[model samples]
Target: MIDDRILVKNVLAGDMQAFRLLIRQHEKLVAHMIGRLVKKDEEREELCQDVFLRVHEKLGEFSFQSKLSTWIATIAYRYAINHLRKQKIRFADLPDEESFTKHFIEETDPESIVEEGDTDAFVLKLVDELPPQYKTVLTLYHVEGMTYPEICEVTQMPEGTVKNYLFRARNLLKEKVKKYLGKEELL
Candidate 1:
């Protein structure tokens, strides 16, 4: 694996191949974040391109305090959020813990998300209904396999908030899964 510092240095020196390497390394993370937050298929591609464009423009300012991927993720997250705001998409406020837990317990099972053979699609459909913050946090932490601190850095959220979001998001998904599959022992 290439070291981040060397890769960054190479890109800064105007090496187009090195820049492509940077994009290749971090594109999945950017795509995962944008995929979770941006619903429009057409806008997803433009938003991803915009993210890398910004990353290229801002490469010189990166302090390297966090991992390169974490920094790139931050850019993607902010860019997607800004795009949503521009589109007048409203993010719902998080409910209180007690109310949230109660609501989930009483929530009805959703319509079948896919054929019975496709559990992954079912789970993804459940995730798609989540609030954007929950979806972003869940995707960053789980899909991208980022650590809590890395997630916090990417989202600019506090460690406590990140943990709370992750916990609540997971609980929400677990409840949804249990309801869908009628499995009581899922955890």
Candidate 2:
């Protein structure tokens, strides 16, 4: 396998095969990120294409200051945010920060535990319920395992803001998972 940097250099030097190799290597990761952020199947497909297209267009600007994955992730993050902004969804329509916590405290029944076969689907559902910002932070940090500094670079937010976002996102997820498992017995 060619090193990612070599693949990038080859692509930059007009090797179309190198570009294809790069996409094949990272397509799954890109698809997963796009899938989590864009709820609609149709929109997700389109957004995934847009992300790769943007990556190709911007490839010449990549300075190798970060990992290729980090650069691709930044493009994916920006595309997702732009899509959300164009949708004009009100943040208030999303469950508020307090309500998410309250749901954890109020909802709990043994029957509510995520069934073994449904864990992924259930978690995805819960993630879809988060506001755009929290969803972005949660997916990038937890799902992708990017560090806070990487996330800050991807989202163009301060390191402190990235930490706070991750903190709040995890807390919200904990509440969601607790509610899924039954709030009363989670303790």
Candidate 3:
């Protein structure tokens, strides 16, 4: 595997192949992040492409202050938010605090589930159902293991706000999972 820093340096130095390598390395992460935010399959693919395009255009501006992934995620977050705002979608309607808490508790705690399969798929499904803000925080913090500060940098939010969002996002996921599992029991 090529070093990310080296790849970035090459891309900045005008090596087209290096840019391709960087895209190949991070495409899946960008795609998954976009998928969680965009409900429409076609739009999601377009947004994913737009993200890479922006990344290429902005490569020279990267200061190496954060991980390349974090930098790319920041771009994806902003692009996704812009797309939603253009559609006049409000972030407030994403998910409630209670619902997120319930889902997190039910899904994250392995003991809550009786059957063990590929919970990843189910988890992704639930995540996709989350509001953009909540989903972004969950994906950045939990899925990508980004530091709170990194998340703040990516989302362009204050540190405290990032922490609060993460807390709320987890809570909301727990709530959704609990409700989902509860419904399964009834069926």
Q: Please write out the lDDT profile of model 2 over residues 52-159, one tens digit for every residue.
A: 888888899999999898999888877877787789854325566677667644553323426555666766766666666677778778778888888888889898
Instruction: State how far residue 35 of model 1 sits from its true place (Å).
Output: 1.2
For candidate 3, write residues 1-187 as lDDT tens digits.
Answer: 8988789889989999998889888887788677777789899889999999999999889888888998998888788878888888876574455665555555454433435565676677666666677778888887788889888888888988878877766655555655657653422
Give the count of colliding residue pairs in each prediction. 0, 1, 17
Better lDDT candidate (1, 2): 1
Q: What is the Å distance of residue 95 in model 2 from its true position? A: 5.7
Candidate 2: residue 85 Cα off by (Å): 1.7
- How would you encode candidate 1's per-residue C-alpha lDDT over 70-136 as one tens digit per residue? 9999999998988988988865555776776666656645555544667777678778877789999
Q: Name model 1 segments beyond 4 Å from true.
A: 92-115
Give residue 110's lDDT in candidate 2 (0 to 100). 28
- In Å, residue 54's CA in model 1 sits off its true spot by 0.8
Ranking by lDDT: 1, 3, 2
**How many angstroms is residue 73 displaced in model 3 relative to the true structure, after the best TM-score fit?**
0.9
Q: What TM-score fits each model? A: 0.88, 0.81, 0.78
Best by lDDT: 1
* Local accuracy by lDDT, each model: 0.85, 0.76, 0.77
